[model samples]
Target: MSLPDLPTGWQVWNEEPDGRVILTFRPDVFTEDEYPAECLPTIYVTNGSRKRRPGAGQYQTEEWHVELFLEPEIEVLTETFDTRDAALEGAVDVAGRFADGDVDPRAHYQIPREDYFAALDRLTGDE
Candidate 1:
């Protein structure tokens, strides 16, 4: 998909045991490019028996359109990116944050990537 812009006030969620992440936002908030092919369009569940992705359209969405990723990651758990800017911003946010150490899955916000100092300069400066 084509890369898009990032969204503002967006947040990433990470699992505690491992270090997987889940980004929850509206699709309209991000761009196409922000999402890469490496990112899978699937969710996970702690219970209810883990079902491997049987291709597309096999999974169901939650009441809040929340994607479940029992084994979370950058792609499997991103918010539905609808806009271009938000997408780009999300890429920056993900690479910046997860590139460093893992975060608490239950945490409201995440820590920035260690080497993201350069991107942070632009990420924080963006409008």
Candidate 2:
């Protein structure tokens, strides 16, 4: 299936032949000098298992998953789907919600970065 149109500040970072897709948000602004690069928001669409085991998700599974991550270790949301297309659609929806300021990334952070959060609010029109 073709990739869907992404919301402002979001882009298709990568797509695998096996249907695993990675979408990134505002890579340009998430620099070391501005917002920490590690905090960049991302959406992963995959058909692999959600198990934490290292190789558990190496093989594709029956269910598709769309996961939103505020950081490498912080997951904001997860949605399951019956098909890859559905998962991609779900990812787009999640991206839209984030771009519209509907998803608050600040809540997931252990140490709040007030300056960064304020900048994000302006970027997402949440201010």
Candidate 3:
């Protein structure tokens, strides 16, 4: 129902009563005009228990999960937690990691945008 405490410069991007949340990092810097949609550092938390099949096995258990995306189709981190609070915490943790330069968005995919990478580095204080 409630969002988690995000890292510095991060804010809630989207949320739903059904327990779907999205947090975006440094919205002031990662503007739509300057950065592509894929370059956005986003953390997604979702709980879709009702969507799971009844006869599904243990692996299909409807538990909370936090996914960290450095870019579109590029999930750099995934963590599962037993409780929603834990999942939210995981999301915040990943956000901190991203700001700390522990995660690289461009490493996974061949992004030729030098300006984007440079802006990202500046945003994260790497430059």
Candidate 4:
């Protein structure tokens, strides 16, 4: 159990000046580590519109998106009722989908980077 390594097309981009970090995953690649057993893929990072859904208010809505950049060969994963540890394990298992080869740290989820930044900016008044 060390976690699957990042597949090709997965990458991370950091913008310290903007206080931002992004994780991107190609739709073609996937691993049993992150998804374990699920269907709906979610972006598992901070700074985005962490809120699952927004109301009718004027709040700028931006979901923490994790698009399936995987090639059509791979199927997307979704969430499940696994134990917290199991769920987290699944998340970690798929960690490579969001790894930063340039840095030692890896992203926690498969969410795209730019959307994460935009969601954060809206929250921190950077918007």
Candidate 5:
């Protein structure tokens, strides 16, 4: 299957044989010196099962979801889609939103971490 087009500043970080893809943004700037690998902005499109909460369930089910991550945190996520194409489209849209600075980590976190905000400042050049 063909993969969706990535945003201007993003690139394919990984592509598994099973069709899962990890896309990273501005790798040229967001290096280890500027940002930690785990905290780098990313979009993950996968058909993997939702990670179960601790002691929350027994049976595991698979679903297609587009996850928008700002470094070590999930800033946004979409409801599960039945098709990979739909998930990919959702992921692409989220990635675009991220590129345009449309996402706010604070909106998701009650109290955003200092380190995370600092990292976000560096990533987006926002003072």
Candidate 6:
């Protein structure tokens, strides 16, 4: 499937043949020097279940899911769709909301990274 136009700072990080898409925000700024590499924001579009159980999504399901994450383990939002097209649309919407600074990533962090938060605010125009 073709990817729709993404908002600024967002890019298609990877696309698998199995129809999974990974979108990342501002990779250039998420370097170890500027920002924590592990804290990079990302969106995942997949046909897997949203269940947390191990191996639950090992097999593809009929439903598609769009998951937004501030970090690898920090899921910010999740939306389910009946089709890949709908899931892609949902992912785009989530990316737009995040790029526009509507979604707060700082709240997900346990240890405050004040500098990183400030930089993120500036990048997302939340400053």
Local accuracy of candidate 2 as per-residue lDDT tens digits, 1-127? 8878999999989999758999999999899988899988899999988899899887789999999998899898999999999899899999999999999887788988888788878888999
TM-score of each: 0.25, 0.92, 0.76, 0.24, 0.72, 0.91
Relative to the true structure, how large is the alpha-carbon lDDT of every model? 0.34, 0.91, 0.74, 0.34, 0.69, 0.89
User: Which stretches of model 3 miss by more than 4 angstroms?
Assistant: 49-61, 111-113
Best first by TM-score, ranked:
2, 6, 3, 5, 1, 4
In candidate 5, what are the lDDT values of residues 19-45, reduced to their tens digit? 577888887767678656666777777
Which tens-of-lDDT digit does each residue in 1-127 have in candidate 3?
A: 3665667868998887657789998766556777766668888887544234664322434688788876766787778888787888888888888887777766666656677777778887877
TM-score of 4: 0.24
Judged by lDDT against the true structure, how good is candidate 2?
0.91
TM-score of 3: 0.76
lDDT of model number 5: 0.69
Identify the candidate with maximal TM-score: 2
Per-model RMSD to reference: 13.1, 1.3, 4.6, 16.5, 3.7, 1.5
lDDT (10s digit) by residue, model 6, range 1-127: 6889999999999998759999999999898988889889999999986678999877789999999987788898989999998889899999999999999877787888788778878999998
Per-residue C-alpha lDDT of model 1 across residues 19-118, encoded as one tens digit per residue: 2234433223233454332322223212121245554333433311224331235323444444334444455445434323222233322554333333
Listed per model in order, the count of residue pairs whose N, CA or C atoms clash below 3 Å is 35, 0, 0, 16, 1, 0
For candidate 3, list the clashing residue pairs, or say none.
none
Best candidate, lDDT: 2
Worst 10 residues of 6 by lDDT: 49-58
Weakest ten-residue segment in model 4 by summed lDDT: 99-108
Q: How close is candidate 1 to the true structure, as a TM-score?
A: 0.25
lDDT-better candidate, 5 vs 6: 6
Off by over 4 Å in 4: 1-5, 14-21, 26-43, 47-51, 55-92, 95-127
